[model samples]
Target: MSAPTLYELDPADSGIYRAQMVTLTDKNPYAASVYVYDEDEYRTMRLLVTDDGKAGVALKGDEIVSVFAHKDCAHPKSVQSMLSQATALGGRRLDCFDTVLPDLYADAGFVPVARLRWNDDYAPDGWDYETFRTYNGGRPDVVFMAYDPDRVGGDYTPGVGEYVEDYDDGIARAQRYRPS
Candidate 1:
């Protein structure tokens, strides 16, 4: 097969991406949110999109290598593409949270960061853990790999807040991940 092409999606493309996210969530119930941001916002925040068009938030600081991609696009190339973009943008640390895509991220250089488990405490009302655990029995683990923007080697760093915003407690709880 030919190599898949990567494109930076426009905001107007949210409908298609959101639909894909829904499909992913159906397959992995622990997924509570799948967000996509416009290029302007993405750039301002140092985020990136993968070849399959999954959005990622870029985390910079303490070596500058962290990204959060939506839990779809279980392809290694997609993670690599995001890493490439992050590197091009001068980032050094890369992170993603898709257990299905860990191998891909690993091959590209990300190591397992932490295993994430969710319950009703992290979900909204009407959400069901039994259903979620059934859907994603293994649950998803956070994976991270370090990249050096100044050099040509990949390193690993732990404990950096890549996806934390001071939203309401409920909102914060919903978006919480290992702060590294």
Candidate 2:
């Protein structure tokens, strides 16, 4: 089969999910709903809540699906903040990719899973999305991280280092896990 639709631009800008850019409808911290594409391309409506005085993302309608902590109930950015959120979310795993910092993710009880490999300038101007995607590398832009609860609040060295430079190796390793 052909590649799954990486994204659908234009009149029906479907399949493009950007959680980092999510902003709730209002300042209501009690419940915030957002639709974002998980690392695996699965479309999901992530819910952010603060009923328990901690900011967390959940899957099932305001329920803590995963990733929660003592957040601002507004927008949390720190890895430690995320860790606290995850723990508060009732032990849900933090399985996601971070283009910013893999080392910091490791410190937050996440294991560096796979290194993403996406080309620069993938999204060009002038509505040239087709051209960009045609040559777009399927690799993610960040390393996939999986929470290791036992390793939380502790300094644990990742089994493998970050930044997979070899193109072939990157593809192979990524394929093996197909991390989301």
Candidate 3:
């Protein structure tokens, strides 16, 4: 098969990308909030769409506050394309979960900074085990990784206008990964 082509969607037309991402939520729960961005912030989200995949990123100056890849397009090449585009657009620091493209991210110089586990033995601070179990949909461990830690810190904690936490507790605001 031919390689999938990536297209950069206009910010004004990002609704279409959001709609597509929502459709994937049935199988990939993380898709529900992958592209959620605060309206008040001066954040410009660059969403890259493909025939079989998609990726969304929000860059505030050089820091990447939010980033996610559509389940369908989380493969090596597609992910490489997404990362390349993000880097070119001034995303120096990336904080994302390793639920999807863990190997790819590692190959690209990302290191694990935190691990989110539903198990009480290793759960992060303020994590509601039962709530995370439900929200995570049986995915036991979600590893948080960061790229370029020397320049940008690998803090997985959500910031304002970045990730929306539907639950009342301190699990990841935007969920990632549901096994197929």
Candidate 4:
């Protein structure tokens, strides 16, 4: 089998990259891990941080290897289209969001889901545990992946304001994969 392609959002992390890493650790002091990958055998890793102050990078031994670039990350329009297709297949994509205007989300075909923390083991923070563990399971840490959905025909970038003007929309399906 062929080797996997090394993917990244930001290849040159440099000073800014380290800062983002520190933020993750600081945010979750009790449980933290850094992801590091082998760049020699595979390609280099690049990572991109989203506007939401979160980047979808896995935890490795010491640091997260850069593998994905935000500049190329799927646009909001693509993600929304993908979600609409999934709905026809009886599949659901759940997303948790803040600061989104309720009406705008509704226009974009999104419904809110609870912010749940599912297990006691992950809920070391008593209050956080109690607050989120309304259901049976728990996963304190989660990652949201980049949007690179498959389109029906060849790639098509809509005209500026085309989507909003043509379709009543606001949010993107990418939010469905957002980390809780």
Candidate 5:
């Protein structure tokens, strides 16, 4: 089999692509609808379509901020292709919360700078990371990663660590902590 083609959908045909995405993929309805209704956001959407699957991504400036795909279409190749296209188009950072894609992102040269887990008690004042629930009402831990390792710092290195609850404090500690 061949790799699916990933491309930017024409703004004029967003509605058509939106419908196809909804019916053909198991993407989150609420997330996919944003592109369908928001004209400006639709311009940043990238889509992957093949005989057997579909995938979508929404870019926030140079960051590939959101991604949704049909279950069958979320293969490594499709996701990798999307990352390659993002890099070619100047994507520099991404925060991956999904359990599966973080590995793929790491393989694409994005280094994990911090890992976050929700803890209402330890969370900082006015912290809303836990409040932004997914469509299924779950808050998966977020992994803050950067495509350019230099963006974090010269001393920062990639290594596994325990999940941190306080976003600000966690990031500061994570940057200084190196796993054994």
Candidate 6:
């Protein structure tokens, strides 16, 4: 099958917006409508494929597919193609929260940097802090992983321990700086 064509959905495109809303809702009920709405506001990108005789979103590329599949699909050539397309028109970085994609991104020459922690003030009511910590304490949810376009063809060696050590150093530094 031909790969689904990618398109940047305009925020004003109600049909695409609604389709994405429906897709997000069906796939992830826990996600708030505001999440989709906000994503539309900022990064309006989607991959469309015909499913059940209707246009629907699919994994943008094999990397995303492998992420969903929870396995490694290291297609270096495919990664290069997607990276080229993404960066051709001035792309920043590919942002994804799925754990599986981090390794693939690393293999594709993207460096896995420190994960982001959402402050407590930003969390919604009824959000499970303990559960969240248990599930993602060591491995944070929002990780900034990216490949340098200049060195796309080279192998990437990820510093897995760096994230942990950095977190510890940050905590120690903050404690030391705190007023006693």
lDDT of 6 at 47: 35
Q: TM-score of every model? A: 0.40, 0.38, 0.48, 0.24, 0.52, 0.45
Model 3 C-alpha lDDT per residue in residues 60-131, reported as the tens digit of each score: 555454445554554534555555566667654444333444555555444544454434454443443344
Candidate 2 lDDT tens digits, 65-160: 334333354444443654445445543333332322445556666565555455455421232333223222222344445555666554434335
The alpha-carbon deviation from the true structure for residue 144 of candidate 2, after best TM-score superposition, in angstroms, is: 0.9
Instruction: Please give the CA lDDT of all the candidate structures.
Output: 0.42, 0.39, 0.46, 0.30, 0.52, 0.38
Which candidate, 1 or 5, would have the higher lDDT against the true structure? 5
Tell me the lDDT of model 1 at 131: 52
lDDT of 4 by residue, 15-134 (tens): 454555555445443222233233431224223334432333322222223322232333433333323333333333332212122222233243332232223354333224333332
Ten-residue segment with the worst summed lDDT in candidate 3? 170-179
Residue-by-residue lDDT tens digits, candidate 1, 142-178: 4344442342334334332243322233223323323
> Worst ten-residue run, lDDT, model 4?
159-168
Inter-residue clash pairs, candidate 3: none
The TM-score of candidate 4 is 0.24
Relative to the true structure, candidate 2 reaches a TM of: 0.38
Which candidate leads the pack in lDDT? Answer: 5
| Residue 128 error, candidate 4, Å | 2.9
TM-score of 3: 0.48
Per-residue error for 105 in candidate 6, Å, reads 3.4
**lDDT of candidate 2 at residue 161, scale 0 to 100:** 36
Against the true structure, candidate 1 reaches a TM-score of: 0.40
